[model samples]
Target: MEYVSVPTDIPDEQTPLLEVYDQIGPKSTFTQTTVNSLNLLMGMGLLSLPFAFYKLGWVLGLSLLVFFCMLACYTAYLIGKCMEFETGVGKLSSFYDIAYMAYGAPGKYFMVVLFSLELLAAAVAMLILFADSLISLVPVLTPFKPQIMIGSILLLTPLTWQKSMSKISWVSFVGVLSLIVLTVAILWDGITSPVGPGSIFDPQQTNMWPEDINQIGLGIGLLFVGLDGDQILNLGHAVFPSLYLDMIEKKRFGKSVSITYTIVAMFYSLIGACGYLMFGNEIQPEVSQNLPLVPSFNVLLNQSALSFIAINPLTKYALIVHPVNSTIEGLFNIYSDTLTILSRTFLSFLVLLIAIIFPSFYKVMGFIGAALSFMTVVIMPTACYIRLSWDSVSWWSRFAHSCIIVFGFGFMTFGTYGVMTV
Candidate 1:
């Protein structure tokens, strides 16, 4: 509950810009932090929920969604506790900082690898999704062959080169607005569209449950991926740590996070439940593809969805590329603006190339969600909590943490296999 002030003695050049911001920038109110957290968690993940729900059946689907939401909230709280554990020495500015404190250099190295891989995969997935969405929005681009990837890279390269999170925060706001519009559009369509015979809400629908274990496993993986918003784990632009550091009343940080997650969970539930109920088994991986395109209102809804899909990724491109940029800069000790621009440009180009090579959007999301998200969101936090509070906490807490670790590994293994095979 105690608010820590930034040490003024550190040299400006030695301090990270983010650290500097924490020191001098105006602190955000609880409301602002809540909004930022909401923006961070909401994204393209919502679009895939209906397909995930369809695979699992309504009962199991909603149950897992709520389960994961609570799990994510708990792990996030564990992260805060871990940060508190290290607060006396200095501020834990990022997840890597907490990792380093928990298990020394090896822990730091492990987090770096997991985060770097996850961000790279996410960026590749975003690029592929953007290209696919653009093609869906404008059928004429189909003839151009790879025009989407090329155009996206060219347009986004300069934007990614911008080095300041403050500079990019506006784009993040725009991305948030896009997500809000997209969410409303999807919900509106779900409400207005006539339910078919196979609707999940209709008793006449058959095969309500998953046909096999494989389908259930895939559904679980997709659901995890759909809920993961930890792309904010990138140290260069992490949301939770920033929110914690920026809170006007540090004691209320937990309350703010709880409110934000609750709102996000509600949004996910509505989108998943309503979308699945509307389309039943007919829903596409990307719900936008399943939206009606003929009626004038429907056409507007479709465009809004497509526009969000296009802009969200582009706005997020920089945040995704930031860790890579920071890594290269730190490794080579290169701090010049020219080098920063060149590095980001090269990273953007590489992401574009990879996206072109492998254009499976939802599949990639499934892989990352199942393989990496569990580790970052569940395993790591729970392990750290156990390590930091082994003697201080109750024995039951340790057992719960152990179970979570086992569940995380099991889910990752089975989920990855399901995604690969299916």
Candidate 2:
């Protein structure tokens, strides 16, 4: 496997998560895990909150965001719990390891496929966001959208070649700062806009619920996508195992999940509500673009915010593709760095091709969150926990897990079908 092997001479203070797996003691503390979890939760997922609210309206949108946040936290807790399960080899060390222990090799392989699909969907979403943002920033380059996305493939392909967490660890900070800048800029613009405070409690163009009752499924799906950490099996799921293992008190990871996800839910609510209020029915899928959509009196201000938002996806692109590259390498046994880089380059072009084919930011992300991520985050963790701890789990616990799985399926099915038809 092409693990992000750290250099022996690297500074202890700058050591990345993957470096200390076998270290004497846990290198990460509870506070550190919570912060890392928050960083992981707050990525590109925020970009689509307004678009989701526009589809489902305020009532369902906010409600679903809260609901999914709790669900994600719970499923994430299950992941940490599954980590304690003995696999004959030792405790689980990774998310897929949970599958391998619970359901054996078949389960492990299924996880690999699902995890890959989740990454593929996420990579495509990033490209769409990248392409869409580029178009918004420079419309004259509009006709060159395809070429721009292709160019992104070339530019970002090299970042994927760096096979160490220390190299990409700094990206978490960039992602957090950029997202904060974009969110603050939007909020500031919205409050100062002529729209007034009324947009807060009640917006003119936004809805409390879907305009048509039949479209509820689509709205729910978009909400699911919005929770995709995205920038995770949308970032939360992808990084959970690493953070969990690195924790000083592993059992307490659930509390970290709760705190991190709630904060993220608040962030999503703030941005989603603010964006929908400002744009109302006219909102675009990427919320940052919506900031300048208004007869923005602040061209320089809005453009700077967009400039900040633009850097985030690129910073996250390689990290997002890292797992996908690693997965393909493991399957094909491509151990050499040369073959690894070649395979990653091929994967980048493949991602670009997929992005071109399914270009709607809203549709693609919604499908991924509902269909692919629903499996990785909601379904798999719950199932693995039940299987791994079936004998000890209470009947009520089983009932709750079953209920979550069943309830989520309704929306997952509806969301996937809705995006597919579009």
Candidate 3:
């Protein structure tokens, strides 16, 4: 259960920016850190929010989005506290570090297992998105989505071999550009053509409230999946500690994080509202699928947007699976080219199979948010905070943390069931 630290052969110039910043003393200003967080994590869940709005309707959907954002923000603060608890063994680097500090080896195992699952789930969701985009772009690429998913995996495998994080940093730009183009295209169409076959602005096309109150549980899960795009700031529990530790002033994490979450929530709410108004009950899981791909400016935007989606995940497959690969290599005390290739191949194929099976971006994301994220974002933070700061943590804070844990379980349970059933 001991966390491994496997050194790579990447040259000094290729070291990760965060590591370099840590070595040189954190120079990241609050604005810079917040912007970095926004750039890296904002869009993972953004595309799905419109359909999330469809599920819970406008009111409840937006409420859950904001609420989940708040939860992610506060838990992030909890993570900072966990790091502050101090094990007298220098700085803690990841969720595994915090877990091991609070509860020993068992905790480290839990973190590794859960984090690995979450990463694969995230990668799977991305694969589904990338494949779906290909099908959307080229209707004749063997209309079967599974085939596209496999083809995309095989094509991206070579790029995934690059061990240096710098080689893939450009992936961030792909995500941000794609988000801007998609958002602009969606909002532009929503404003310019508010009434037409592809345009919608009627009560029948949208609702302030969901027709079934019972869906509120399922709605929470779905919206959490989408809102998680920002609230976790896409760092996930595994990577967040490093970002937090790299801050110029760790004390300022709350402020920078709060501002980042607010920006993400507002943008998500706006796009969710606009997409619903445009496509109403017909919005696809990715939202881009509903864009008016007519012969116009929008079509050009669609091409750019789809191209980005297709390429974005291809870049991430290696990054997400790297941690898992490292953990296994470090745990076994063996590292070689053969091991790296086999591990990456096994992980990629595993996720590809999962994507081919579930296939629905919405459902897969919902399960991730409901099951994995609820645990990492909600349960783990509070648990770690209480364990690490039980004495110094305020009495009210302790009670609040406990209450949030119970609530998280309900959300995870019901939310997961809802995804499976709905």
On lDDT, the candidate that comes out on top is 2
CA deviation > 4 Å runs, candidate 2 = 1-26, 158-172, 196-202, 232-234, 336-342
**Tens-digit lDDT track of model 1 for 106-173:** 99889877877888888888787787777778867766537777888898788777667677766666
Candidate no. 2 TM-score: 0.87
Candidate 3 lDDT tens digits, 1-422 = 11224344443644543443355542567777788766655656777777788889877887888888888888877887776664554556678888988899999899788876777788888888887778778867646888888887898676655566677765656667777878877766666664543454432277789877666555676677654443212445455576686677778988887887888788878888777777777778778876634343367767777787777777666776666666776777646787777777777788889988889887888888787778888898788878888888699988988999999998899888888787
lDDT of each: 0.73, 0.76, 0.73
Residues 93-173 of candidate 2 have per-residue lDDT tens digits of 787778888899999999888878877778888777887887878878878878988888889999889777577767656
Runs with alpha carbons beyond 4 Å of true place in candidate 1:
1-25, 28-31, 86-91, 143-145, 162-169, 194-207, 230-238, 292-297, 334-345
Error of 3 at 338 (Å): 2.3
Superposed by TM-score, candidate 2 places the C-alpha of residue 150 at a distance from the truth, in angstroms, of: 2.2
What residue pairs are clashing in model 2?
229-235, 230-234, 230-235, 232-235
Error of 2 at 295 (Å): 3.4
| TM-score of predicted structure 1 | 0.84
For candidate 2, the per-residue lDDT at 185 reads 77
